[model samples]
Target: ESAEEVIGELRPLLKGILREDKKSIPDMNEDEKIMHGCLESKPKHIDSITRAIQMTPGKALSVLLSLELKGLVRQSDGKHFSLH
Candidate 1:
């Protein structure tokens, strides 16, 4: 599937999950909440994934690399990632 398609699929899933988690537990920072949600869901193209959860480009790239190493995602291109 295309990168955009992958991103489209992940977006709502991430949002829904994050929203539910936020309602259940409070006091998490946006990035921490997003990172936790993403890790749990194993979404694709997460480096480029932006929403209520935002990060610096460098931090986002680092998270992507870490996820790749953990086998949750695969590097599809220099600029894209896919759930594995």
Candidate 2:
């Protein structure tokens, strides 16, 4: 198949997978903990999140990055984050 045809065929499946993933919360404890630390509408600083989640900044950053990739969180202003 041509590149466009392959992409077109995969697009719907990819979209369905992505939509299903987003509908379910991550099962990891760290992910859930950090997610709770993020405010619903107000962006919070990394330091505040770390404190609230009681995780080392490095570990929290790692979890936050994972959450960002999962489309459940958004990072802003370099060090701030909020639920997406």
TM value for model 2 = 0.60
Instruction: Write candidate 1's Cα lDDT for 25-76 as tens digits.
Output: 3344455446546543333454446432577767766766665565555665
lDDT of 2 at 52: 77
C-alpha lDDT score of every prediction, in listed order: 0.59, 0.80
Q: What's each prediction's TM-score?
A: 0.42, 0.60
lDDT value, residue 21 of candidate 1? 79
Per-residue lDDT of candidate 2, residues 15-40 (tens digit): 99999888676655756664555656
lDDT of predicted model 2: 0.80
- Over the full model, what C-alpha lDDT does candidate 1 score relative to the true structure? 0.59
Candidate 1 global TM-score: 0.42
lDDT of model 2, residue 59:
83
Worst-scoring 10-residue span by lDDT in model 2 = 30-39
- Candidate 2 lDDT score at position 47: 90
